[model samples]
Structures are given as C-alpha cells and as structure tokens.
Target: MAKSAPIDDVPTHGEGIRLGQFLQLAGLVDSGGEAKEVIREGDVLVNGEVDQRRGRQLQVGDIVEFGGRKARVSD
Candidate 1:
C-alpha cells in the first residue's frame, strides 16, 4: 500500500481539452514538443492506462498521470 502522489485539479475553462494542451496546462511538461515526445514514448497515462494520442480529447474528470504526477481535468 504505497501512497500515491496527490492529484491536482486543473481547470480547462471549457467542455473539454486535448491531452497535449492539458499536459502543459497542468504544468506537467514545458512545451508541446516535449509533451509529444514523452507521450509517444509511452510516458503518459490516462486513467491508469498509457495513451499515445496527444490529440486525445479529455473531458471533465479525466485523470492524467506523468512522471509521478497526476492531474484531474475540471471545468
């Protein structure tokens, strides 16, 4: 039973947002290029599963994890 990192709530200010943009919005990565590279390298997780699509549409309540950090989408 290891303690998981606290999930941070990030506001999208819309109905939904792309995974790449959200990653940067939550301060997970510095730039879109970095986000794409990491995402393609299988370093990003969506709700506990690896997702490679940077354009993946994430709605409210979607959980994204990367580099031991987690962020939940919010409107």
Candidate 2:
C-alpha cells in the first residue's frame, strides 16, 4: 500500500503562487523542471481535480496534492 503524505499548511508569502512553484515551495517536487513534467503529465491536482497548467494561480486555502502528498496554501 502507498503511504499517505502528511498534510501540511504551507505559507505563501504573497497574494498567490504558481502551481509549479508551489510544488517546490511545498516540497512536493525537487525542481521547476520536475514540477513542469509532473503537471504536464496530469500528475498534479488542485482542489482535488487534475490541473495541467503549471502557471495556475493558487490562492490561500487552495489545496494541492501530488505523489501521495497533500499541502494547503496559506497566507
């Protein structure tokens, strides 16, 4: 069985953050290149739905899940 990622509240020190960047800031991925790859491959989810846009703007309270891990945006 796959291990569940610990859910965390990651603070975004701004009004919004890009999906690809958030993946890195939240420690979901290692690099911007990896973030783009996973996002393009339909491996990333926003608020529980697959979001392919790497530049998708994320706001406070938004939820992101990838690679069995979950993170919530915070201001």
Candidate 3:
C-alpha cells in the first residue's frame, strides 16, 4: 500500500482560481504548460475524481491531488 499525501491548505485571495493556476500557485507544477499536460493526461484529481479540465473552477474546500500531493482550498 502507498502512503497518503499530507493535506496542505491553499488560501484563495479572490472569488476562486482555475485548476491550472491553482496548481502553479501551490508549487505543484513549474509552468502552465506542465499543469495542462498533467491535467490533460488524467494525472490530476478534483475531490477524488479525475478532472482533465485545466480551467475547472476551484473554490474553498475543494481538494486537488497531483503527483501524490494533496491541496485543500481555503479562505
């Protein structure tokens, strides 16, 4: 069995942020292209379900998982 990823809190400064943008802000990926690539390849998840939409809206409490790292949206 694989170890679960630690939950990290990500604070949003506005209404919400896009998945790709959030991934960059969380330091998950180095560039937008990278984020897009991973997301398109089904390497990212939103609240436990695979989400390939890079422009998916992320609000407070939304959970994002990528590369074994999990980030929870917060105020």
Candidate 4:
C-alpha cells in the first residue's frame, strides 16, 4: 500500500514541488542523479501519469510513485 497525506494548497507556493527534493526527502531514490535517471527512464509517476522531468514540480496533493513505493504530499 502507498503512504499518503492530505495536503492543502498555498498561494505562496507553486502547485507542484521539486521532483529531486521530494525523492530525497521521502528517502526514495538515494541521490538526485539517481532520481533523474529513474524519472528519465519513465520509472516514476506523478498523479498516476508517467513523468520524466527531474525538476518537475509536484503539487500538494499529487501522488508520486517509484520502485513499487508511493507517497502523497500533505501539510
């Protein structure tokens, strides 16, 4: 099962957060480079869609999946 949290959107911040930062913070991929590779290879998903941008910004409620693990952003 994937871990998810309820997040509220804030006007001050962008709808999505940085991909590399999110992976690092979640302890998913070890390094930013690794995350980039995974993303480039279509190994990651954002909101149920394959996303290949390492710098892609994930929204507050967006779901991120990689390596059979998933997480949702929350406040």
Runs in model 1 lying further than 4 Å from the true structure: none
Candidate 2, residues 11-30, lDDT tens digits: the string is: 98766889999999999999
Off by over 4 Å in 4: 1-16
Ranking by TM-score: 1, 3, 2, 4
Tens digits of per-residue lDDT for model 3, 12-37: 86568999999998889999999999
Q: What C-alpha lDDT, on a 0 to 100 scale, does residue 22 get in candidate 2?
A: 97
Top model by TM-score, which number? Answer: 1
Decoy 2 TM-score against native: 0.90
| Whole-model lDDT values for every prediction | 0.96, 0.94, 0.93, 0.73
Name the lDDT value of residue 66 in candidate 1. 98
Task: List where candidate 2 sits over 4 angstroms from the true fold.
Answer: 1-5
Local lDDT at 50 for model 4: 94
Which regions of candidate 3 fall more than 4 Å away from where they truly are? none
Tens digit per residue, CA lDDT, model 4, 1-75:
966543323231444568877876776789988888888899888888998888887777777788777777755
- Quote the lDDT for 63 in model 4: 75
Name the 10 consecutive residues with the lowest summed lDDT in model 2.
2-11
lDDT of 2: 0.94
Candidate 4 lDDT for residue 1 = 100
Q: What TM-score does each of the candidates earn?
A: 0.96, 0.90, 0.92, 0.74
- Which residue pairs come into collision in candidate 1? none
